[model samples]
Target: MERAEMKMKVLSTVTVERTDDFYKVVDQLNRTLKDKGLTFGFALDEKDSNKITMTIYEV
Candidate 1:
């Protein structure tokens, strides 16, 4: 089976509360995309003091 490549496009930008345990959120992001049958292109972390902004892109 061949895996389909995700298009280069901006999907959405999500922000989560700042926390020491960030792995959960990252995992969730991966799961969410997988559930949607989408591939992850890239993620940009734009974090501030109290929150983190993630710009998600399709692969």
Candidate 2:
């Protein structure tokens, strides 16, 4: 079967000292997408020391 394509944008904020937290969030997001039969292309951005933004495109 062919996989469905979708586009998703996610934004998250974390303290600089807790940068690792972003990985967990990203992992969960990926899992959610996979469960929905979707693939993701991630565009990551560090808005600041306490802010981050991720844009995910399904391909």
Candidate 3:
């Protein structure tokens, strides 16, 4: 399949209480939204492990 390049944008960055299970939700979003031009990313706050930074991107 031929794909065209699209510009990526940072939709949002949210900091919330961290949980291991959040990875499952992020994974599901990536799988379900990749073709819709949206991607979800996640990272733990380096200074505070109890917080997670969730980033949504447009692609």
RMSD per model, one decimal: 4.2, 5.7, 2.8
Candidate 3 regions off by >4 Å? 1-7
TM-score of every model versus the real structure? 0.46, 0.40, 0.81
Summarize candidate 3's per-residue lDDT along 1-59 as a digit string, tens digits.
33466666999999999997999999999999999999999999888999999999997
Tens-place lDDT digits, model 1, residues 1-59:
34465354667867767677675666777788866654433233544567766666665
25 Cα displacement, candidate 2 (Å): 1.4
**Pairs with steric clashes in candidate 3:** none
Rank list by TM-score: 3, 1, 2
Query: 1-52, model 2: which lDDT tens digit per residue?
Result: 3435543444333233335566776688778887664443333455554544
Question: What's the candidate order when arranged by decreasing lDDT?
Answer: 3, 1, 2
TM-score: which is higher, 1 or 3?
3
Q: On lDDT, who's better, 2 or 3?
A: 3
Give every collision pair in model 1.
Answer: 6-59
